[model samples]
Target: MMHKFLMSVYKEMLLLKRDFGGLVILFIMPLVLIITITLIQDSTFKSIHETKIPVLLVDNDNGQISETVKQNLNESGSFEIVTQIDGKTINEEVAREAVFKGKFQLAIVIPEKLSKDLQLKVNQNVEKILGSFGMEDTASVAQKNIKILPKEVKLYFDPATQLTFKNAVKSAIDKMISKIETQSIYATFQDQLGENDAPLFDQKSFISFKEIVPKVNDKEIMPNSVQHNVPAWALFAIFFVVVPLSINIVKEKSQGTLIRLITNPVPYAVVILGKTATYLIICMIQFFLMVAVGVYLFPYFGLPTLDVNGKLILMSIVALFSGLAAIGFGILLGTIAKTQEQSAPFGATSVVILAAIGGVWVPVFAMPKVMQYVSHVSPMNWGLNAFYDVLLRNGGIGEILPEIILLLLFFLLTTAIAIVYDKKKREV
Candidate 1:
């Protein structure tokens, strides 16, 4: 079996030696991509905020009424208005044009009546909170206290705008509201009852600093980029790398080379294993190159530095295996695809979509709840999270065991499927 496996690896190596494309796929390309992505993410195109709401302000109430409304919103610090359109630009022409241009996420035309509306909403919401209608109406609530009604803030988002971006902004707003609400409640209590016998609420801390290596805040910043990014990217970068290489496999089969190999005294299992082994080696190299470059060069692009220690080493190994899983998955895809021309689009599309969901292209925290849950099935998310746990979370090897186990499972499953597929194909 060892002899057979060695021969299989040798055959794949020979093919690669002749083509020389494997080096680029496994090492050079992944490194280049890692650098590029790191640069884009770390660049100071804008300040990172807890939640930056791209709101448009149309201050129609130019007098103290509008100013008071603006002061309240600003004091909450829940949003970052991208454009502050003049009160004079409150016309339908300006509003429609701005909306079409996508200058802001939500538009707020502070109608001259905004102050009155807010006071009314506040009074209504507070009244609802107090529950003081009539004696008969309070019969059901006689035993239990009523829940605090959430402050009803109106949103004026353009429905035609990009849904994903819009949702992201909305989430920010929600987070901001949740954060400020505790304070708002406390302040209201203080105003109503003073420090005497009123309900005491601890003020929530604002996220003025992120936990980074420099120890910018109370929480420790993540130690390295590898833990933070590698797991997400292992599958992401390899998915891209696999498309071209896997398509080559389909090309070989279509050109009759695979069929010819089947008759070369080599077991079909051996042949398939050799191809997969080759891809694995290539992927391993890709993983190393991307990580090495990312550790040293990432800071140049404004990305946080990767920590180098036991944690870093372990993350690299686990992430590399994930890349191998991706390669095996690609091989399995190639074997099933039947034709190169037909395979290319499907393979590429699958990788891209999986990568996006896997948190390769974006932080999982940035994704919606549904996507976050859905991505759990993909190897990319596991790998990315493992890296994060190992590096950033300062997790030991034991902590990352689950991710490594998952990668091993993926490899075993894909390899088994590839072997079975090859056997069936040869039988035909």
Candidate 2:
């Protein structure tokens, strides 16, 4: 039995060697895909945290408020405030035009008399408080009847800006103005009471937030583009083996190779096992090559390095089960398909559909609730979640076992169906 299985494996190896160019393409294409995707996404990630967006600032007031806004924005390190363009200072009209033309994503127009009007408003409110307490001077009570109109600060956004970005900018500006108003009120009260008096309250924040990332051996291991793309595209490439594997089976049937093997004394299950072992090895090689690129090559391109650290064994285990699932699916496809035309396109399209719904192109959490539930049926989703568990979540064998078992069962079920289908066809 062992000898017959080895011979079957050797025959498949010979067939693969005969088509050397196809074998090379299988390895190279996925590496190219992984590198290209990682490069594109890494820049997007950096732009959010490291790149500064240029914004037009029209300081019509040029008062304390405008100066404070510019200073605060600069300190945040997120915006580059442009007060001038082409050697000319920008006004509200020019800022609006630039933003509308999409030259800048955002523009801020600080209205004239903002500082003076804000101070006047604070003064009136303080006097009103004093009058309600019966503590205002007789002369000050007469001045409280003067009404001050509210000042407006205008924000112009590019038409292409997302609504979330608009809301975030608005919230930030509102918070800044609220803080400035509170401080001005406090200062006015100090002058009214006595300059030598202690502060009314501390201005420092009492609450704060800090992000806690997953750690391994006391070192933080944050997920990055490379970590995500390597496993995802690798699994994609692994499942893509179905196309060639199915086509090869169809070719063997057409050429009478499979018929000859079935007529021999060797069991059909051994032949299937032989094919499975050969293709599983190919899938593992594809996975490790992708990991090697992430670990060794990504850093040279200024992308974050993929860190396997102590999880190599667990990752390999997941890859092995994933490969088996893909192999079983290939066997079923090849067994049912009548010709290469039927197997090739169907195999490729099914893999693509599975990948799309499997949280490969987008995260499952980002999908609509209905789609999220639908994604659970895809084998690729199972493999991807298992990979993420080992790479990002610091999961051990116990944590990954459920997914591993699912993949193994998927392999068995598909292989059984293929065997039954082949048997029924032979009897017919």
Candidate 3:
């Protein structure tokens, strides 16, 4: 009796050892995918504009003031300028129409009336603030205060225009103020941005859309970057574990050993239990190796852990459960698949597609609506979100309970399907 159990376990181990290609994929492939995806997947690039914001510039003034504004906007790189000239594409109607096509996020119509507006408003604020200090309200007092944006600098962005895009316009206006000879004019708004003067505009502000810019929560709490990766990338990593597990199970079935075991006194449940147990162990080992190595070595890799010692242990158990769920899924795939050839491609393809939607490779948040909803079904998203809760979110076991339950549910459902499939296919 002992020999039979040992044989089964040993056969599983030997299968792993002999299939070195499998070993490479099971272990190394994940690390490679994680690193590659993490680098390109999230925006780490330090662009002033992290997202490409579209801008439409209508230079109604067509003079030095409008030209300066145009130059400043271009230099800001906060915009992808779509030039409209004369009545053709340059009109407000045309610019507004462009927004519907998803052509531009914002439109800047430089009214033919800009210079006079700046002269009037600049002097008014300058005289009011500087004059309040008991100084004469002279031309010098007005000159000293002309730093704020002129009222003529009108903005007509779609309300849907992002806050960042709106802020970019204001920032560009600020940069323009810095270029003028009068220093005191813009000094009042210095508390906002640019302690150092921006002499001439530079293209360094062009934000690469491929990179990720972090969003700060309302609270003072700022997290490490890994916690950020945990939500998306780790989910991706855990999901792909199924590919290896499925291939492992399909191999056993293909070699005729699974058929031979049915004739033995061992119950079918025991066979499934033993194999599932083996996979669970393999996956847990992998989970720890990734977490440990990621924490100690690849610090950039986002794999979070618990702050409370007990919770950390519980988190590991949760991860173990998630891995088991993945293995259960692999087993189902193996049983239903007529041959390893059929199983291998289908398993790999399923994971690749599902993981993509789950935000392992790219954030599921970034995926379109229907796919995002579909990803909720993927175990990777649940496991990854749970891992995030423990590590990055500083969440407790209670927070991850739903994820744990869902993972187990997936396991039970997949196992039931596999049992039915295996029973029917045994004769074939």
Which candidate tops lDDT?
A: 2
lDDT by residue (tens digit), candidate 1, 69-146: 466556655566543366454544565567667665576554554444444444344445656543222333422443
Worst 10 residues of 2 by lDDT: 42-51
- Model 2, 403: alpha-carbon shift in Å? 1.2
lDDT of 2 at 314: 90
lDDT of 2: 0.90
List the candidate numbers ranked by TM-score, top first: 2, 1, 3
* Candidate 1 colliding pairs, count: 10
Which residue segments of model 2 deviate by more than 4 Å? 44-49, 136-154, 159-168, 192-196
lDDT (C-alpha) at residue 381 in model 2? 94
Clashing pairs in 1: 26-286, 211-221, 212-221, 224-307, 225-306, 227-387, 227-388, 231-383, 231-384, 232-384
TM-scores of the models, in the given order?
0.65, 0.89, 0.61
**Model 1 alpha-carbon drift over 4 Å, by segment:** 1-7, 21-56, 60-65, 72-96, 104-106, 113-219, 222-230, 251-264, 356-376, 424-428
lDDT of 3 by residue, 22-103 (tens): 6667777666655564455344433446545667877777665777776766676655677753545677778877765566
Query: By descending lDDT, how would the candidates be arranged?
Result: 2, 3, 1
- Superior candidate under TM-score, 2 versus 3: 2
On the 0 to 100 scale, the lDDT of residue 384 in model 2 is 95
Task: Tell me the deviation in Å of residue 153 in model 2.
Answer: 4.4
